[model samples]
Target: MSAGLLRNSFKGAASAAPFFPTLLDQIPNAIVIFEADSQQLVYVNPAAESALDLSRKSLEGHNFHDLFGDNLQLGEMIHEVKSGQAPAQRQELLLHSLPGSIHQETIPAHVVIALMDDSDLMLMEWFPIDQQLRTERDERVTQQVEANKELMRNLAHEIKNPLGGIRGAAQLLEFELPEKGLREYTQVIIKESDRLQTLVDRLLAPHRKAHVMEYFNVHEALERVRSLVLAEFPKGLKIVRNYDTSLPDILGDREQLIQAVLNIAHNAAQALSVEIEAGVAQIELRTRVARSVTIAKQRYKLALDLDVIDNGPGIPADIRERIFFPLVSGREGGSGLGLTLAQTFVQQHQGSIACDSKPGCTHFHIQIPYRRQEKSE
Candidate 1:
């Protein structure tokens, strides 16, 4: 063979040598490749199959349009790429599968498409956004649930025993005291009991109650918490805002949302106390729109993302996962219910909450769906 022809033959073999299999196995993103001429799928990675919740054998030879359906941005992008146009836009699509023998269930999948080409084949990579999000959400929820159970058990033993003793002692003192001062001492006991009861109630609320969903603007709720934090910390802390103006009103109970955001923000503020004393405590409330997020195996059309970020001594790595449990505090006198309650409230909204912490910074990310429709005026 001529040298030039030999070189061309080697290059062609390299192009067809299951290049995608290696890429798909290594990269986290789900990827699919298609033939430019026929628009048929030639390759799918394990991540792609798992994300789509399908088998590789089933997806092979299927056209991109047939797999994703009609009137979708992803389909259009594929067409453009096939027609030799380099499109520079990312398209998000909601994929629903037809009921079939496999699992005999319908699945909602979220995919993002990007077009690339290698040799003569068009590479159409479909990323399963929903699956990734859902997996993370479920893990967090499971961890929180287990932590709350342990917390309730411990708190019941630690708190209720002392509370009972305090109440009994106060009753005895009231009986022995003079009539005028009796009411005053009795009132103190009653008030203290009531406060303790309230705390206990808050701790148990997640286990006893059902989640209620309502419509409210997330930004408004965050703003309320921001103002409250600022008022409390006045001169020491700075509360910064980074909001996505286009985010729609979220579907959640207003009060629950406020408490959830406030709980996380309060923790951030407390972490910044050393910085606050030095006149540089900084906390931020940020909001954004997220696509293709799944919670509890269900995919949402759009989700609200609220991040509470702070610059301080970050959460200790040893207890990072345990922080959401009631009474698992990082501070000397801290009650750990702040994060537990926050998780419960967000979970009630059919949403998810996660935390990532390291030295000098900590961030809590909350994801919930937006209201389906606006109320008419």
Candidate 2:
């Protein structure tokens, strides 16, 4: 090779090397490059590592089919790229992986399989369905939270001012009444005032209380909530427990956990009331162990997975994303603080709560870290 040709060759490789990897890094989606012939991962970006809940060190040299199942559609997409069919557009794929146990995920990906310098490589880029939806969601949630605070403040002031006066008037009327029958009307007014006071109390609970953390068994917390829900909907609903006994104890407040779990289960039971009347309202309490979990941008070695699944009409699309904010309710008589408070409690424990809903199935998945290593006293 001449000196000029040698210089041109070095420039070409340098330009291409930076171009591909830099492009991979800049893209918002998780990108992974695999050697088509060897069926091994060639490169993975930080996003890919986070999406898969695995470190780049663990992902390198691993086959896609081995990490995911061999039968996954992503495997077939890889085959097509290697066979000289360049992917024309982005593809949506559902992936199943058994890291330790079965896990199912739906991923929206854009893939390109091509020959780079006489070597076949498959480039796959994916973003989680939930993460893509979260950008718009977070903005809306911020706005809603502010609006809710103002609304709560104004409503609390408006209601609290007259509540005492109403009770006082009711008491005066009770004393003035000559007969027991007339006193019943005053008693009803007093009861209504008390009910309104209770609602106000619930509305202000999230803002007024401080988070207190302690070590507690998650299963015990779940069972406590389950029994309460079953008792309330005893005639129609069947609450089933599916506990993963291997899950370690988590550090969280027992009362808060009880309230959080009960809120979710109570909402589920109420949603299933109609079905329960027909002898079909079924609520499942499932607990499992999640590994390499990420909650609030932090990773945990072990996490507890608690799922509350109900058989009812799923949440409406318009408000599905806003269900966690204060005063967003699905039911007519519901105050809507239940889910909001539940989410607040869970986040205080450095956990996350997510919901997946369709026509007949609604699942609220809660992920909280478990204490894998105990502190020495």
Candidate 3:
């Protein structure tokens, strides 16, 4: 994350250290402190500067409410906060004509007013609710994923030890059986043991590979998966590319990422058997740069946003939550390891994946943080 973003995120901690204006300049929210009587702006945070898309030099010493074009509700809230009639607390509403951002979309904010009683200054903080909710959601997701990994690691270890012995015993017994009927029984045992061995090996696959890191174009992996998918579903499956070609090359395991995307696309193709038959199946790979993202409680200024969207029947509602759990498959005869493996591979890159599904739509959103090439100021 940018230093400004970092400072703003920890404003409470920074407040005790000093009263430096630079501390708040890069926050992701619009904060303006003003005199109660004159309504003259005293300070504007960096987030407020960015939100309005104007410099503090241009906005300071101006009426804070005057910058808003026609947001009666927001203006009234500001007036009330300035009056100090009562503590306005937090109010949710829309703001219009934020100076330099007049042509941009309307800004929705959770506005809170605070009284700096000692200085007789009124502090108005306008936070975008979307960013607030997103940070909270990211925190929760991180916690849940950590919990899932711990449980799965323990279970995999437990299942790992027994399979080897079972397979070895079956092979030893098969060589001793001389009668054809008894040998047939031994053969069945050996085959089933081999199948279980393969299954157990897959359960441990995510941990087996050394994460080879190299700077690679993400589209290379996407295109490879696209070709592989097309080769299988040539008749009706359409793979659309919505890429941000301007994105810098990402550092990751190319093979693992290819497998991750392929598994997701393959799953979609399977679900769209009917659509593929009727020539209406469509799967999309979209990419964009995400801002102000929080992964594992760490803030990031830029992250890759890769979305795989399918217009199939969607994931079953009952199993949506467990879609990434090992052995949890919604499809008949499905091994259910694809998504789990994908999640593991992405996590290896210090990134993550999430899914949202409803009938006729399934979205797999993957986020991978860009490693900063230089130290952030």
Candidate 3 has which clashing residue pairs, if any? 25-46, 30-48
Candidate 3: list runs displaced more than 4 Å. Answer: 1-25, 30-90, 94-145, 373-377
The lDDT values for all models are: 0.70, 0.72, 0.77
- The positional error of residue 336 in candidate 1, measured at the CA in angstroms, is 1.0
- Give the CA lDDT, 0 to 100, for residue 28 in model 3: 54
For candidate 1, the per-residue lDDT at 309 reads 87
Candidate 3: 10-residue stretch with minimal lDDT: 1-10
- Please report how far candidate 1 places residue 355 from its true position, in Å: 0.4
User: Against the hidden reference, what TM-scores do the models get?
Assistant: 0.60, 0.68, 0.70
Model 2 per-residue lDDT tens digits across residues 103-214: 4464544444344443455566665566546656655664566577678767987998799899999999899888989988898999999988888887777667776666
lDDT of 3 by residue, 154-195 (tens): 887887677678767877887787776787776777788778
Displacement of the residue 211 alpha carbon in candidate 2, Å = 3.4
Best by lDDT, which number?
Answer: 3
Rank candidates by lDDT, best first. 3, 2, 1
lDDT of 1 by residue, 1-377 (tens): 12222223223443444443554545555666665566666666555554564666666446766655674556677666556565434566665542341223334444444445353455555554565776876687676686666768677658877887888888787878777655796878868887787778777776666556566677888889999989888988999988878777667678888988998888888888899999988998888765545667776656787888899899988888778777788977787789988987887777888898998889898988764756679
In model 1, where do residues sit more than 4 Å from their true spots?
1-121, 124-147, 150-169, 177-195, 205-213, 371-377
Off by over 4 Å in 2: 1-105, 110-136, 178-181, 289-303, 316-322, 369-377
TM-score of 1: 0.60
